[model samples]
Target chain A: MPIKSMYVTYSDSIYQFIYFLVGDDELAKDLTQETFLKAINSNPQFRGESSEKTWLSKIARNLVYDHFRRKRLLKFIPFLHEHEQIDYTYSPEQWLEAKNEQYELYEALGKLPHHYREAIVLRKIEQFSIKESAQILGWNEAKVKNATERGMKKMNELLGGERDA
Target chain B: MLDSKLRSLERKTLDEETKNSQLLKLNKRNKDYMKKQKFTYSVTLVLFGLLLFVFSQTITESPKSIQSQQLTNFELGEVTKAYYLYSKRADRMYNLTSPFYTDKIFTTDPAVLNEFELLFKNSEWLPFNGDLTKYTTSINYLFQLENGESVYLKEINEDGFFVNPNTMMQTKLAQQSHEQFVFYWMHIYMGKNEFPPWKIGLLTILLLIFVYAAIKSNKRGTIEKNSSLINLSGLGLAFFCIHKMNEWLGVNHLLTLLLIFTFFMSATVYLHILIKKQEPNWKYHIQRIFMANIVLFVLFI
Candidate 1:
């Protein structure tokens, strides 16, 4: 695909990925800009390896992991409460309904180990197949399936319900 | 129970956010790359120009003669009446009855040996015999003859032939008596003369300008300015002037003084820049220039 169309197609997905990982709108916007610049400058070997969207998302995920690792090393606690009051672009009624579910899920997800959360997100939310999720997370298919199952079981227990059929 | 909820939530939201974030990261990286490229190109151009200017200056200057003019005049017999005249036609064979000879008439005298001893002793009055075997001992000896003449002797060792010191001295004296007229004529042309003090002062001023310009060009960060090239050229010209002044004036001490001042000024500027982490100020620059001038003036005067 041409560079311009690839950027236009993947920009939103990359931004959304960073926003979910970091939970900050502004930082997500900055990271999205940085990810596209990297995509444009990267070698053409990327064209054969994966779809442009997947390649960009991988770069964004690496950046997000780096940010978290640095924060952990520096003992920084990001001010999450500051983001609680802002009105998102989505309507309040639709947002609140989704946000309540998101907030409860995020809380339960946060309680799980990082690997389980990542595997579950990639497998279920991103709707990647078992093999694709394994490839993205650098794990085998069985490990991804196990983490996804554990993450789902833990979330059901936290939400006071049985696992979804 | 809770694991299912987290899994469902991750499924619903992560795709949208990941796409949006990647775009933003790529944009920022591009800007940083462009800025770095510009800085690299500018530095390359400045270095190239400096190299070109240095090459052009070197090519334009004429090659200088290392042999002193006094030495040349002495060889030409322009000052002294005595000179060694070698003729391919007239005196190719031995002149068997010359007064300087203690040989058996014209036959090769094994006992008298060669006339090189008489020539070596009397070289002060003569020009060089131009023989490698005559100067087989020491190259830079002065021999004074009874005729109040002098000659400079250099020892040249021909293959396996050695001229002893006594014979070397005598050979040099005979050569000088024969070459005295030519040596004196060369001496008048080779007279040592001093450079005017004003010319040395002017060169010192020019060198100061170059040092000042180099400092200023570095400060502006655009040493791309042509004035910097001109200033550097001025420095080369000034150095040449100092060299010529030393030669003309026969003042070797002045060259040492100039070198010391140049070294100190360069070191001072380098240390100030490294330690302060800033460009040299005008006050320090001017003070260094003034100090260099004072040193130059004292040495030259």
Candidate 2:
């Protein structure tokens, strides 16, 4: 694919990845735009050491880390409005009836610990291969697989497995 | 059965509804980001060009001398000789005005000492005149006042004060006079010379450049890259101190001391910034110490 078309095609997937990490629609949109702008303006010698998708994902992840660092989130966890109690469980029929599961999924992702949330976003939402996720995240493949498994198990515990529909 | 069902749900593909919404959002955001980046880059370019123009103009201008040739004549010889002799005796103080009398006194020829002396005596100046015997060899007159203050006046030929060619005193004196004139003019008259003002302006321009670079990096979401601006600011500050020290102390003992201290402090702070990888809080402390030193030096001057 030409570089421009490839960028356009992958842009929304990158946005979904950032949305999964931040759990705020506006902020995720902003970060996603920033991620692609950076990728396009960067020196063209990307050399494919990893897939373009993985490289862009790494840039998105770094931007998310920077946002949290600036917000000093670790120092003010209790004050985070996004972490307030929410109704996670849903009857199967009710889940089918809701118009937007994406927002719900995003909020639940935000409440997860950083490592687990990152693993799930890469593995489940981005649907990156386990090896690609590990490379982008600077983790071993075993660690990536373990974190994804643990993150999904924790998600089951949070939502109580009622909305598999 | 539950695990298989969960797997199937997780594997669901992106429907047209979600894909279209994501594309619309991405397109709007990308446009906004590109516009912001372009605006920032243009502003930076214009500022950089303006600074360069100002600095270049400053460097190309001529330097003006501060010493007056009118003060070097034989008619003013007596007053000038007395001033220099007094200054030398007073631990090299730079002020040439009389400590005894507030006004200047003029005399054309120094050979007629009694004429000058009689003029003072008729004014009822009752201060000590050591003896008249010294006046016979060279025209010497003791200008004495009732307040017990005296200045020994001497005659000079057409030849003026002899200055040694190899002495550093002449160079330092010239620099000191220029600096004094520049400082006085800047503070009292809102005027500035090309050299000092240019140097100060250039350093300020460099500081702004680094700050802009940092902001650009921040906008691009690169915080670590922005740290380079902090380092650049630190270096610019060190150069500023060197420039100020050159003006204040000249190229002499005091200047040497300032140079060594400035280098040592700047290097130490640079190392700290690079090694610790923390926000350079120590740079502010170092700047405070340097400022205190400048205050003390200026007070002495």
Candidate 3:
């Protein structure tokens, strides 16, 4: 497929996936573009053994890994901290209701170990099947199941589920 | 409640402008990459063609020279012009030779004719088949015949011609006096030249770039050709560059060790970038390598 049409078809889905992983509209937009760019640049002959959506998810996941790697590398230099801004696209009523609760939850998701966060996003949030998540994340089926289960419990714990109780 | 929040979070998709703008960026990047790929292919073809041409020229000597060798026994009535070069590099002679010189054979003793006949009869041709690009010859004899053709052997030293092992060139050379050798060295156009074997390194670099680009162009979906090409080419490029770097530095010293280590580090990082399927900064790596080479050259030579 010509790259433009392919992007038009899958850009939103990929962008949303990246947005949830990155928790920033602008960075997610950049990485979404980076996903397609990396795919075409590095592997132009993507024949879709898995669906194109799966292939794109794989690329976006790699970009997220790279993003966190750079972030981790930057952690050593104490003064350089990125003030991550949370800007969600929402109607006014949804924004008022979600402004505090969803913001904290999304921040918690971002703070999760990347693997867990990725599994939770793919499994619980994006609704990818366990097998599909395995294919995308390059893990075995059982690993995917374990990560999803552990990831959901971790997310609840991160939101003070046990602490509040 | 967790499932509901996760569902609600999924509902918050990107705004339309961001999606469309990103589509435009992807479109632009795709077009840019296609252009870059075409450029890489064209450059690689041209470099490979150049390499083939140089080797071919080396292996296949000028047919006219071969024809002249056939007529070596065609003794001349009178020589037109003659001047022999002295202490010269094979590289410079192959690159350029003045067509205005004649053999000192005519300016010497008349008994030289008998000497020439003897030289031809008992001539022991040393067949040196080294590549002309890197091969250095202490060539001296350059002769202009009646037909204005230069009979200059590529591997000519102070004594005689060394024929290419591949060629059927059986030309013989008479031992010349020291006076005659010095006479030609004093010529206005001919002088000693110092030729660096830089072209070999260049062709090596070009071949590497061709292979490296071939590796990158290999697609991921095809495991058979793709992964092997990447691993082999990356390793080969690293190996060849290391060898070439040693040859270039020409000394087993600190600088050479430092440079090779630095180079291997960059290559390892590049391998990581490829393995991870990160956005390929191949052009960055290529430029960095080429720049490192240029810098090393400037600093050393």
Report the CAPRI category for model 1. Answer: incorrect
Error of 2 at B247 (Å): 10
Clashing pairs in 3: B81-B102, B82-B102, B82-B103, B83-B102
Provide the TM-score for each candidate, comma-separated.
0.34, 0.37, 0.45
lDDT of 2 at A87: 22
Candidate 1, B33-54: lDDT as tens digits: 5455445545644764674455
**DockQ for all candidate structures vs. native:** 0.09, 0.07, 0.19
Note the chain A TM-score of all models in turn. Answer: 0.74, 0.75, 0.74
**Using DockQ as the measure, what is the rank order of every candidate, best first?**
3, 1, 2
The sequence of per-residue lDDT tens digits that candidate 1 reaches over residues A43-99 is 222423445555666677666665655555324434233322222232212343557
By summed lDDT, the worst window of 10 consecutive residues in model 3 chain A runs over A79-88
lDDT of 3 by residue, A1-165 (tens): 557777878888898788777766678878988888877764534544677788789878767766766777435444213312222232222443457776777777777766777788888887888877987777789989997778788888889895233
TM-score of candidate 2 against the unseen true structure:
0.37
In model 3, the Cα lDDT at residue A119 comes to 86
What is the Cα-based TM-score of model 1? 0.34
